[model samples]
Target: MINFTLDQWYGWINAFLWPFARLLAMFSVAPVFGESTAPSIPKVGLAAVIAMVVAPTLPPFPALATSSYEGLLVLAQQVFIGMALGFVIRICFSAVQTAGDFVGLQMGLSLATLYDPSTHSNTEVLARLFNILAMLVFLVFNGHLLMLDVLIRSFTALPIGHASLNPAAWMGLAELGGKIFSSGLLLALPLIAALLTLNISLGILNRAAPQLSAFSVGFPIMLISGVLLLTVVLPHTPSYLNEFYQEMLGHMARIADTFAAPRGGAN
Candidate 1:
């Protein structure tokens, strides 16, 4: 049997535990990995596997005993940092879904909804479709790998338990809330403009001919127009989404920077 002191055992445990906490928090909130339909065993197992892989590169944890108050604080900090990172990614996907919802509404498909098992909520059909497209692009282009890269770089950028999340960082996260709307609106604008014009023309026609059934005529036009408009938009999503993905991750890096240790500072 190998001789190991209590401190040695604790150090070994610390090496794994802290990274695992952060990875678990990340997967709990990160896109794709966080979906409710994702099996818990695999998710946790993946986090554990990654934590093990990254463990050797981690800066040394504080010398304080694992059971100490400081250790608990460090654990919490890891969770917060992981969550902050994951939330940024989640926002990007949400924006895509929002854009789809806007298009669906314009197409008079608002009533066509589906149960989203991932969120335990009802989402418009087109919104789900857009989300699936966005997700596929994310996977095809290895965007999720980029997210993992960010998480790994974060250990260097933010370090383990080196700094506390401040009010400003939290505020920065809140700002992403508005970003969802702006980006979503940008994606949906062309379709919206087209549909709005169609609706207005239909309205004038209805006024000119009272016998014209605007409901019957308007619905078909909007349906066909929406489908055509989406076809135009869908092909371009990958490029636009790529730009948005980079922008979102860039913000996350900056957030990590806020917590970075001063150059050459003692661990």
Candidate 2:
């Protein structure tokens, strides 16, 4: 039987360690897995399991060893790469949340914030509804599968030890952020215009009858009108969610391109 020396065994274990560490780092900070609501023990366990599965499929280990500072640098780079990918997806989801917040504020539902167990932050009621709907739609459309596919493809496109950020890619991510305002405004436009009309009408009524309590009269009417408008627009939400997922996948593809580009090449 073939025999391995102590140094050879150490080298073999080290070879797996770096790749495993990189994968763990990626999963640790990546959006869904990185959320604060996720238990630390489970997250660590899942990361280890994923690393075990993915490490063998990856390219050969880089020359860097865990014993050196360079290994730590590589670990950091891997984590950054994974986090950047997850962040892009997170930003896309935030567009819907932003739109919901704008709609809630315009509709006088600003005080209706609720604790979101997923994100562990208080979110507008409308935003929570939309976010939950978006997640459901994402699963319904197999977007989660697509996301996993992209992550797997990343291994080949941007192998281990090949982490580097592209400026153009970053600019693209910034542009994605800019879409939030546009999309949010678009989603809120109809409601905003209707509210403005109601406000103007109330103003006229107030001017005509000083004895009338505008606040008392206007609040219920506005609330009812907002509810009716939301009902009317509810049917369109699925279409918007579908579009958002499509855009998200496209952005992920762009990120892949950015990560896959040569060190000095354009994304």
lDDT of each structure? 0.87, 0.72
lDDT of 1 at 233: 75
Measured with C-alpha atoms, the lDDT of residue 194 in candidate 2 is 85
Error of 2 at 207 (Å): 4.1
Best by TM-score: 1
lDDT of 2 by residue, 1-267 (tens): 999876676457655665556555655554456566779888778667766777777777676556678767776766766766666667656777787888788678889999987777899998888677766777788876676667666777777666565667766767777777777677667777888798789989999999998989988888888889888987777787778777777787678678668666864
Q: Where is model 2 more than 4 Å wrong at Cα?
A: 1-31, 117-120, 205-211
Which ten contiguous residues of candidate 1 have the minimum total lDDT?
A: 258-267
TM-score of each: 0.94, 0.83
Q: Model 1, 174-256: lDDT tens per residue?
A: 88888788999998898899999999999999999989999988998999988988888789889988889999889878767
